[model samples]
Each structure stands twice: as structure tokens, then as C-alpha cells.
Target: MKGNAELLARTDMIVAAGGGERDVAVDAAILTNKPKSANPEAFLNERLMSDLRPTLFLAQLSNLLAGNISIVHGVTGSSRTFMGEEAAGVDAVRVALARIEAGQSELALVGGSHNGEREDLLLLYDAGGHMLHAPFQPVWERRSGMVLGSLGAFLVLEARGHAEARNAKPLARLARVLSERSARPPGAVSAALTRMWQTLTPHGARAGMAVISGATGAQPATNEERAWLKSLAEVPVRATGSRVGHGLEPQFSMNIALATLALGREKLFPPADSSGVEREYEGPLERVAVTAVGHWRGEGMALVEAVT
Candidate 1:
């Protein structure tokens, strides 16, 4: 059986143990223990390579094949370190996609994990020597501490004809995936907005739906991102992310979850209730978006459809 089924079974067992209250929400759980290491960095590195890497690999494969995957993850200061000249995570995804297009592999699994420990009041640094630093906002004061999280994400793509012949289930028909970076004039938020508007409008026309996830706290960039999304008035827009908080890992997972839910359940989960701002948006606000300003610890944040 798949890990998700096993997890559900385990949850069922727990619920049965507690007399199976139908109305009870399952609290998230984690299992952890200490391992020996000469230093904190060494310990995190070992865990990343051994435990987290393989887990993410499996999760990615499952995501591509069965569309059922679990993200067992943690994060820490050390795991954020840059390794040599290579970028990680999404950059890795870009490279893997290129390789697959070049016939390197039929499918690719891509993901990352991070962990941290306190070292003389400094967080553990990965072998790449990067350290964790918090966003400059005062709201994050409580988040400045050691953390451990893992992320597992993957996608399955088949040669168009192959997928058609096999009658395989497709989670989303990926029309296009593109990346852009803009180094605008120092104060040109307007230009940034214009560029985003142009890029998204055409895509919205093609897809007929767009999901926007914005960041939390004092990051006005989140607002800017949402505005750009709103400017794409050609289609219905669903926003998410103000609820679950913001970080790349959680955003990635939450976006996938939203997409999966859209493709499967035909519904969107509600955004988290972090900001006092009431949910506002016209039309079907059934998609979500997320942003992260700086460091995050504890349970991450995500925003989804208010009505599940």
C-alpha cells in the first residue's frame, strides 16, 4: 500500500483507539529522535543525505505516478547554505526538466530538506556555510530558533502520445512553465507590476483560471504580488497563502495541494486566518497563492479557498 493509505490507516487506528469521533479533526503529528554526531553541522548533513533525501525522492515518484504523496520534511539553518556554485531546489527542478526534455530520463524526482541546531547562539551552517537569518519584521521574533523540516515535491510528464495511449491519469495538463527574473530600477514597483500584469494576463486568457498566493506580515511585496494577480482580470482568480504563512517549501506543497484538489475534488481549501483582514475577492475565489519574506519555523502557513 502507498504511504498515504498507510497514514490514513494509522490515523484510523488512532481514531478507533479514541472511539472514532466523526467530528474530530486530526492533529498533525511528527516523530523524531536524536542521533549521535561530532558536531551539529555533521548531524544535519547526515540526516539530509540519509533520511530526508530518500524520503523526498520516493515522495516525488509517488506524486508523479499515483498522484498521492506525503511531504515528510524539516528545516534548519545549516541546510540553507549554498553548495559550491550550484543553486538548489527550484533551480534543480529547472535543470532536471531540461535534462528530461533532452531524453536524460523519462521522469525526474526533485526536492530538498533542511535542518538546524544552535551553535554558540548561531544556527548550524550547512557544508555550504550558509546560515539561517530571520526576516527583519518584529512579528518573527518568536520564530528565531532552531528548526528541522523536509520537503518532497515532484511531477510526472510523459511524451504526449505515450500518455494518450496509456490512458494514465494526469493531475494537471501543464501547458507551459516559464521562469522570469527582473532587476528593475530601485524604486520601480510600478514597472514590476506592469511586467507581471503583462505576463499573467495572457496566461490567464489561456487557462481561464489563476491562483494567487500572497505572503504574510509586513511584506508589502505580498500585496504587490496579489495586485499583479488581480490585474489579470481576464479569468477567475483564486488567492491562497495569507493563512498557512509563507516560505518556498510550504508554498510549493500548498500550491500542489490546491492544484490537486482543483483537479480532483473540484474544490479549494480555505486560506488560513492569520491577518485580521476578512477574505475579499469577487468571483470564484477557489485557488491560492503564497509568499515568504524571510525565515520561518513551526507549522508553515498557506492560503486556500475560504470555502472548501
Candidate 2:
């Protein structure tokens, strides 16, 4: 009865939820009705500790989301949680796919959720110079960087045999998913993407496939991914952040879900900008290569292909 039984439900299963930031409790000091002291920073730690219930601290257990889902939805399956900004979500999918392909799992649910509006999260990101300021710009064009976005996404993955047993019609096939982490020197990201692209290209010609990039409007990383994309054969490329903003942990799942839809419909969505990096595709859509480049770490790619 996992709350998401509508998508995936079983007495035995594995569920993974990837998250960049797990909770919004860091801003508890500002939420208090009490007046701010001249030096609130002096007693910030004490005040926050006193305000929170004994059972709950400012550091929220990222797994509570899975717990809640189990409680509400009745999914009594084994669960795992990972936290590492953008890479977490990508790994979640990678693990689920591995399990299925290895005959370790028949069906599973995996994804992530994000709340971009939290003041505390915003403050932290702003401190890092990651927040995009006013005067809107697409992810590629934004000089100030990523605009946070709230998003929740999940995917139901089933093995071919399991799917055939249930007579379920899959919209698309996950041909391959690969994830890697880079030490992140200036050119490291581009090199990583090129290596990943090579792995995804053997499935078919580079010209027939489109790319759905999880390029958050963030710096160095976005530009690096852009450069890597330029080195590839010219194909229709879409920067999802331009339309959905940046959803961090859930970005990989969100982009994969959207790419699946595009593959199912056999069409590409409208491009978000006129950067010439993304252009129109005239052929029937057959596959999409989804890319996820983290703001600070993690690089991943998924090859989604049409089954029929």
C-alpha cells in the first residue's frame, strides 16, 4: 500500500528516494514569532534546539519520506535513501535498473522530490552564488545561475518478464543508464560527458537521437555540459531547466519521465530558447539521451529508446 501503489505496489520491493536537501528546518529561527535579537546569530543554535521537539531535530532524516509513504500507502518493501544533490537521483535510477537487469528485482519504484521555495535552502544556495536573480533567462543564458524549482517525480520499473506477465504496456524502454562522478577540474566534466556519450552512442546513430539535458542554470557545470554537447554530432537538444527550472535531486527522474513521454508520442517538445544548440528534428523520434550534470558533482546519462 505504498502511497504510490497506483504506480508501484508490492509486499516485497525496493524503493529509493534521492534528495539534494532533505528538510527545510534550517530556517526555524526565522520562522519563530519571537523578535530577533541584535545578535541572534550568537544564540541561534540554542534557540533552534529549544524550539524543536525532542524527537525531531533540525537535521531531518531523509528517509522519513519513505516512512510516510509506507505508512500512508502500505508499501512494506525494503527501502533505501541517498542524499547527494543531483547525483543522488541519478544513482537511484541506476540502482533500480541494475537490480531489475540482474534478476534481483521484478518491479520497483524510484524517484525524488524537491521543495525549491524554502528560504533556508535558498539562503544556502544564494551564499554559494547559485540562485538566479530577477530578469528571467533560460538555463543556458542565465548569468546569475539556477532558479530553484519544486518538483516530485517517480517511475515504475518492471522487468520484461514481469511486465509481460502483467500484460502491461511500457511506453518506452530504458536501453541504458550510466552515472559517474568527476573530480571537477575545468575540463573534467566535458571529458566525463564525452566518455558517457560514447557508451550511449553504440545503440544507434547519433543523428537519430535527441538529448534532454538536466542542465541547471548553474555555472561551470552547465557550460561544461554545453561544451561537451557541442562536441557531439548535431542533434536536437533541450535544456529542461529553461522550462521547469532546476529541481536538483529529482532532476534526473523528471527529465527521464519527460523524455519517456516524448519518445512515446514520437515527437520532440518545443525548444526553450533560440541558442541554436537546440533545433527542430524532422525525423520520427526513436530515442533520447538524457544528461544530468550536477552543480558541484555527479555526471549521469540515460539512453531511453522506443520499443516498437
Candidate 3:
């Protein structure tokens, strides 16, 4: 469905960004004058050449948002920009769904964008104690940290015969997109989310299963992903950072596009957490399991369904 000559010679673009916003008053005047600079490293390179802004290092250059999305959505064939923040949006949709399932590209434009009202990204997540100044809970009833949200998530991944040869109508079915990186140690992010949830549900979690948690309520990785989501008994979990508030690298492609719009509206949207780990599902919402647990490192999982 990428017209404009397949978005200029076959669309492909992966981007999960960072290194793009800072200059909160030139980082608060170089942390209030770089330790009373008597020559503190040449006054921090003369306040980084007169207090920044030679286009602010070419606008912070994290591939300049894939070079401005290949110049305003002309999606120039092959492009990537994954920086390690929320595992660069889970390996930019697991390398654009593994380069369209190994044929090596057949339309893609993964996702990412965040600007959570940056005061230098809330002073780099409040210097790792990880923001969230309390009182506005609901990321599994928080009590830990994180609460940054400003988003722009994309998806448009194609190649079910290139989206049925362009007639296109796939709102879901990115069957699997797993990833891991755990040196976390104490039950390491719930054993790397139980080995990527038994390698994305190996005959488990059925019956209209639901989950759309990019659970960034921080701390011990959201309490080890709420203890591996209490083994999914009665599934129904939803923590799009408790209603859109943790956009770290576009929060796992914005919770896999909010679990493909709640499996294309078959349901599953209430329960903004009265702490039952999100419940109140009125049932029948086909398969959707999108979890990314990167409060301080990456661990991903995906398994959206219902494209039928």
C-alpha cells in the first residue's frame, strides 16, 4: 500500500530514536558553569562552542529521524535508526518484522518518536531513579517511577503478498517479534519474560488473549513485569503505560499500535488499573500479546493476531 512508486523504490524504514532533544537552557548553563570553570576542560570546550546550536549538532542527529523520514515520507527503500532506549523500540519492530520474513523487504516503516515534554528528557529519566513524581498512578498502580509520554508511532508493515498486492487491509498479524538482553540478574526481567513468553505462546494463552503492556512503571522492571504477569491467568492486561505516558523510543511501537487497535476493536480497553493488573475485559478479542519491559534495558515480545 505504499504508493508513490512504492514510496520511492520500495518502502523500508526502521527508527526508534533518541539523542535528539536537549538544551534545556544549554543544559542549565552547563550545569551551572561546569564546576566553577577555572579551565575545567577549557570550560567544557568553551560551553560547547558558545552554548550549542550549530543547528544543535544537526538537530541532535539520531539519524535525524531517519533523515526526516526520508524527506517527508518518500520512505527511501533501506534505512534504519535504532538507538538503545526501550531497545530502540524493540529492534525497530524486530528489524521490520525480520525484513518482511526474510524476503529482505517488501514494504515497511516501523516506528518511533518521543518528546515527553523534555527538560532534557526529564533530566535523563531523573538520572535513572526514573521520573514519575507520584500521585498519578496506574501503570499497574505504579509506586516506582516513569511517566513520560509524547508519541508518534508508525507501523505499515506489509508483505502478506505485499499486503495482498496493494489492496491492503491488514490491521494486525505480526505474529512474532521477540527480543532479549538481560544481565539483570535477580530473576532477570522475569527470566527474560519467561523466554519471550515461551517463544510467543507455544500453545498457551488462548481464548481471546489480551495484553498490551509496554509497562514502564520502572523499578525492578515493573516488578519483573508484574511477576511475569501473574502467569496470565485470566489474561486481560493493559498498560500502555497506564494510558499513554511512557513514550521511551515510542514505547514498543506504541504497544504494537495498541495491540493493533485492540485486535481491531474486538474489545479490551477499560481497566486503567484499579490494580487488578488491568481486568474487566468483555471478551472475544483475538490474539494480542505485546509487551516490552525496558525501564532500564531491553526485553521485548510480540504476537499480534486477528487479521482475519
> Quick one: best lDDT, which candidate?
3
Native-referenced Cα lDDT, model 2? 0.78
TM-score for each candidate, following the candidate numbering? 0.45, 0.87, 0.40
User: lDDT tens string, model 1, 154-236?
Assistant: 44433344445656555544332223333323324334445434443444442424453323332233344445444545534
Cα-based RMSD of the predictions, in order? Answer: 13.4, 3.7, 13.6
Name the weakest run of 10 consecutive residues (lDDT summed) in model 1: 12-21
| lDDT comparing candidate 3 with the true structure | 0.83
Q: What's the C-alpha lDDT at position 112 in model 2? A: 73
Ranking by TM-score: 2, 1, 3
When summed lDDT is taken over every stretch of 10 residues in candidate 3, the lowest stretch is 1-10
Q: Write the per-residue lDDT of candidate 2 for residues 1-308, one digit (tens) a residue.
A: 13456444453333334333433464544546335566666566566666556455422577877766667766665677777888888888898899889988777778878888877688888899888889888877766488888888888788887788778788789888999986898898899988888888866487568999999877798888888878765788999889878888888988999999998888999887777677777777888999999887899999998887
Q: Which stretches of candidate 3 lie over 4 Å from their true place?
A: 1-8, 12-56, 61-63, 68-106, 113-119, 123-130, 133-138, 143-156, 163-206, 214-235, 238-245, 252-254, 257-274, 278-286, 289-303, 306-308
Model 3: per-residue lDDT, tens digit, 6-97?
45657888888887776777767787888898877888888888878877678688988888878876778888888888888988899888
Q: Relative to the true structure, how large is the alpha-carbon lDDT of every model?
A: 0.33, 0.78, 0.83
